[model samples]
Target: MRRYGIQPVASITDDLDIAPLLITSVGRLLWRYRSELAPVTMLALLIGTGTILHSSYRLWWPTVAGITALVAGVLLYAGRWVNLTRPIERAYAATATAFAGGWLTTSTAHGPFTKPLPLVLAIGCVVLAAPWWAHRRRRARVRVERTLAAWPDIAQAAGLAGSRVQSAIVDLWGYRFRLGLGLGQTVEDAVAAVPRLESALGSTRGGVRVQPVASKKANRADVRVIETDPHANAITWPGPSITFITQPAKLGLFEDGAPVRVPLLRRHGLFGGVSGAGKSGGVNVLLGELTACPDVILWGIDLKRGMELQPWASCIDRLATTPQEAEALLRDAVIVLDGRADDLAQRGKRVWDPSPARPALVIIIDEYAELASEAPQAIDHADSIARRGRAVAVQLVAATQRPSKDAMGKSAVRSQMDIRVCFRVREARDADLILGQGMVKTGWHAHKLDAPGKFLISSPDHDIPRRARTYLLDDHGVHTTTERHSTHRPSLDAVSVQALERAAEMPITEDAPPPSREAEKVLMAALRQAPAEGVRINDLMRATRMRRTWVYQRLQDLARTQQAEQVSRGFWRATPEKHAQ
Candidate 1:
């Protein structure tokens, strides 16, 4: 009998222990699903409130109705203050408020247990709960909350143990969070673990981007998880984003839907990529923006026989299509650079202030490698412009396949580029050549860029490796934009014109005969050797070591006698008969 009595007492103690455990488990489940059970909790609260009001303030139905109207009106009119950004969300909130207040008022006026009142409350709860359960932003916010709540485990899996989510926000494309890292952990450590973090967070490859926080705290990182690509499609050109070269040009949209603006004034830019990586399209877009600015004069060098830049010929102040032409164009650009420097020195100014009356000059060189190889003599002039052009508002924008030292004429031109835009490349090492040395190890990864028009930009303003896409300006867009902007194009400023005139009038030597005769001989020889496609007039000028007027005069004399013929619009070549003669 003593043993059995002891067993019963022990059983009573065990039962007491299990009772609290069971209650705790139940409470944990309720809290875990609180958002899903919100409608049920709200219905119960309404019932209790209605019962109390009916017992104490049964005559307050009118006051309740008035309050409901005021609340609904506020929600409908100024719902954004409460984080309701969409009109549909605001309307839903107002309707729900009016419905709940109407049901409560009726319950207060009549008995809380009235026949239709209880049925009406049940129907209203189901109707309102449906929309609340299906809202996208609300669901996203819930997911973010749960993800952050489990961030410690995620961090551990991603090799960032002890890192905690400090704050988070959901946006249209995806969500981002502020991460507080463990001791000795830096933003580089977080960036290096992006692939692991993406796996731990179940995001797609390249979806996780870890950047240093704006405050530049050592232990903080801004982690962005991209659920949708904002630059997936070819963004159409949006006319122009600037009226002057002083402002930054809007190149395209970043992955996070922010504008990729870089100051082009007084800056030399280098754009590099593979042949089909949309580098040409990027150049066209750049020209479209620059052409619209009245304070900019555009020059282009397309050694592919003007196939790429011919569409914008109306807007371009000068376009070069051959090796000799490229040389002459760069040489003239140096002349303009010198002229502007002189003007600035006269006025004691540090930089050239561009205006419609005195516009900036932008020389865009396509296939810079071709220029380096074909016009080796021009590289010295290009190097000079690259070094001294910035202070005088004369800038060079060189586009090439790869900016190797040899490809860039083994000169300082590549080193002088302040803005580097790298599109997709065939090899990983090519990214380093285009962007900088060791950029691949630093996570630029331009080789992995999946599509055309996609690029990675590096400038003084952009230090991180964020992928962006350039706007696409199709053939029709090119035509329309050029036609519209051609009429408004600004001419060469007086300073630049006077400099060229002075250069032309300068004497070659005191004893040398007139240069026109010898220059004509060199020009004719170049034309005879020119390919079937013919040579550009700029090339003739460069070969003859003369000005544009001198080259045109000789060309007209040859054409009138049928010794040379105009093969195309801006191209000339000695006639086959003249070559035989």
Candidate 2:
């Protein structure tokens, strides 16, 4: 034998061990291709069993078939016990098991080499094996096996030499493995070596992510290998998902296609993003659901001259267009809040429970930075509400382009936000501004969001950084929702109305100005110029220079005399004769 790079063997004993060497070489070859030999090995085992049964126990074929059916049934329904998560994969496994068992039963009744039995076995094996070979999970499993086989070398090269893969799960998006660090190693070391690990494991540049396992020991990590993109398209809205004001509103779908249900009942939320980053669309979805609730009273402050909130003005109880109106509206809300608190105290209740008679107040503020700049005083009231309103079911949902300390009027507004959504931002630090400080460094990479609707939510229920996309509610949707729900919109409860009356120092009237000659002429002018959609209570208050109680009282008297009409809830306009008069 020719040995190119070795010294010549001169000893006869060293060269004479051919038999043992041949056996050892064959053993190594079999070990190397063991997975590929699995099917053939199983086939051989089946053939041996068939021969034994046919030769000595052919009468047991019926029992074999019964056992086969039972096994197939167990495998089909309880396949999760064996790690089959997908229904299709479980079905396939059951089918294969049935085919093999039935073929073995028939073969046992005849012989392993029986002509038709052999043919059926051959055809069935190939047919069943086709799916096994083509299955994604099976392929992924094989890949995982190969990777684990080379893990020692990979770990050594990636500066994680002492770590070992404990277990792995192949998912729809990718695969995740639980890794056990060495005695002195920590999960931080593994996280720090993520880039090198990805390279060593032959994954894409940004494919690997290492998360510490939630355990007291700092020696375990969950290493995920992302092989697929989850946020490839915009998930369409599935309509209003909430009926009552107490349930969480369905925002959109997360990367895993699960619904993103966010609780809006008593929580304050802040939506921050760049211009045209689907912030308005997300808020519209919230409005669509909130409008459908009968136990919620909707209020809005749109400082962009009501451009964003006007579409749903018919449903909103109060809509603020400019700075002065916004200030007045917030002040009134605070009055209502204080009133509810006193009522709760008098009733021996710790918190106000909302019902149709006592609806929760949700204020949707669009472009909150404008409110901060134009009506800085309103921010104080907002801060008060944020700090104390949750228990009483008074919530604020603010959307802003920039929610910095200065942009938010250098108040506790940002800090008071319990639920925050950070959309696509220009800088990494901007994520910290929206989601709170140090969020960017902790892997809340909102700046990496590629799409407009994509965002990361930080709330009590959702603390983990999972990418989610908001359902887009366009202008048509807004108009449709407002029209459908405007009639059912709940008016502010008596407690809030009474509070407003005390603030105005007059008895509130739903229908006649509390005898104000100066306010009557201004109310008439506003009624004449009111748009087809009519004007909201705040607009009428602005026009009439009167409190909402006086406006309602005067409007009631005008409607009674056929001089004015209510176009929608909380919206009134003058009749043709009244306008001319």
Task: Write model 2 residue lDDT over 319-374, tens digit each, in one string.
Answer: 88888779878888888889999999999898877788999999999988889889
RMSD of candidates 1 onward, in order: 7.3, 4.6
| Highest TM-score against the true fold, candidate | 2
For model 1, how does the per-residue alpha-carbon lDDT over 1-581 read when each residue is reduced to its tens digit?
66667543444554477878899999988987788888999899999999999999999999999999999999999999988978999999999999999988999999678989999999999999999999888888888788778888898999999888988988777899999999889888897898999998989998888877768688998898989887778899888888889999999888877889999998999999999999988898899899889999998999999999989987887788889778878888888899988998999999989999999999999999999999999999989999999988899999999898899996599999999999999999999998989888767889888899999999999988888999999999999998888878886787887777677567754533455666777888899999999997767766776666346656766887999997755678899987998
Off by over 4 Å in 1: 1-16, 45-83, 97-121, 508-546, 549-581
Give the TM-score (vs. native) of candidate 2: 0.85
Q: In model 2, where do residues sit more than 4 Å from their true spots?
A: 1-38, 52-59, 74-87, 182-191, 212-218, 506-515, 518-539, 547-549, 552-565, 573-581
In candidate 1, residue 368 scores what lDDT? 93
Structure candidate 2, residue pairs in collision = 511-556, 512-553, 512-554, 513-554
lDDT of each: 0.87, 0.83
* Candidate 1 residue pairs in clash (backbone atoms < 3 Å): none
- Cα deviation at 30, candidate 1, in Å, is 2.3
